[model samples]
Target: MKRIWKQVQQTLRILGAGILAILVLVSSTVPGGERLEQVRAYTRGVEFDYAGWMLAALWDKGQQWALSAPRYWDEKTQRQVVEDWAALTREVQALRAESARIFADPSVSDPQTAAAPVLARLRAREAEQARLGALSEEILQIQTRAVLAEMGLTYGKQAVPSVLYRISKLPLALVVSPREVIRQDANISLLPDMGLDEITALEQRVEQELGVSALVVQIGGVAVYPAMVMETTNLVYLTDTVAHEWTHNYLTLRPLGMLYDASPELRSMNETAASLAGKEIGLRVLERYYPDLVPPPPAP
Candidate 1:
């Protein structure tokens, strides 16, 4: 028994040493450990006093909770919703761009004739998109509600979340490597490269030429992490991603989220919780709305 206890202690010591070594490497000039100095520089004396805005978010969430529910449509109307809505959104975005370009001049008086057609088109697109957006919201809300029921989570005087998903890639993104996020006011960069080698070479050049450590983080999708809230167009991910973000918002009022910046572990915990919950919520959406896509339930 004594020998067994000694072995247990030895195993624990080895684990701790391994973790410490990894941390040192992460802070060193290794491929996977490149963010060490950058992270240190970014986090120096950071106050993490995000409560001011988080409170606003909480209040807005309450208001959202009290809002009227989205109108549901029959299956006939729901068919081809994703493809059709995406097309309309593209048209709407184009019209909006045209309107802005045509109306950018302050010196140009009597712009009505030139702007009327564009404005009319914009209005029509907006109207149609709003209707379709509402239907999508209804579909998502069903999943959100189902997840809440499954997890015994409380909406807490909040009405159903307005998960009115639309695919709108932000017009611009300043892509970065190794998860060094350049974000402001909910805007983040998207990877704009045509192939993996481009981003990989960029990261390699950043490290090799700059004498720093940066390796590709192996992210292989249109979806960005944590910052996916920046702007998204994929409905398949939008539902769960929105839930993940809202979980962060919900955790804002709790000790867990508040202490997010206190340590890496807490931040990981917070994000992990959000991701787990978000995936579950997305699965609920599939189960309830896209049953055709769901796998067969297990037999007794």
Candidate 2:
């Protein structure tokens, strides 16, 4: 009887040890597998959302520009641009749909208790996507205002006299007024030598070139992070652009950012803080340097 009881206890101990080992293996593998799957799934949703918004905005703005400046943009060209944007949008949408289908499979839906870490990672990814989307929207709004301001002179009445002017012999000057003009970068030329379509192409080229150059200068050979361009033709825009760029500079120095390279939420916090700072700095710069050229904030 004593020998039988001892044997039973040993058997129980061996079973418990085997169970523990199995649990450990599963816990280690599940979280990593689940996290990769979830991130891929959520990223698809985010991509869809971003593509839809961008396409819609582009279509709306292009249409508005076409209608407003019929003399500048012909119907065929307008339609072509719209069609191009739509095609890109559709491609992105299809990619998202395929990802969604893969993620939604029943086989993939099987969850393990060990997947908790992966689930947490997925949540973080989703949050970051949301943050980036919000920041993009904010930037788009600013760009819209800049577009309106730029177009206002031709489409509507000029609200302010031209602060930008061309000089034949001397470098181009950004004249706040007759007496208070500043000699900015000699390469800063708003005037394009091409027609509307050609000008658009040139602008894109210039933008890409300048963007790369700026990244090299500002980030010191590091890979460029995600960014959006906001127009800087007006005082409000100038302030915002300065603030936005400065924010990027700020994040490169922080420790929290070191842990996560592509977190949208962290980027948003960095951007928002920089934007606020830019606003403050811009207002002060205007007050000190171009007091006469200060413009009122656009209605929110």
TM-score against truth, every candidate: 0.44, 0.24
Number of the predicted model whose lDDT against the real structure is largest: 1
Tens digit of per-residue lDDT, candidate 2, span 1-300? 885565456434433433432333223211223333433332222221222322343343333322333224443443344334334434444544555555566676644433455555555554554333333233332332333344442234321211111001111111111113322111121221223564344434433543311100111111111122321224445444543443443344354333222343654565567667556655654554345656777799
Assess the local accuracy of residue 42 in candidate 1 as a C-alpha lDDT between 0 and 100: 26
Tell me how many residue pairs clash in candidate 1. Answer: 3
lDDT of 1 by residue, 168-251 (tens): 322222223433542211112223332576546555654555444444332222211111232234555666776765566456
lDDT of 1: 0.48
Report the poorest 10 consecutive residues by lDDT, candidate 1. Answer: 219-228
Q: How close is candidate 2 to the true structure, as a TM-score?
A: 0.24
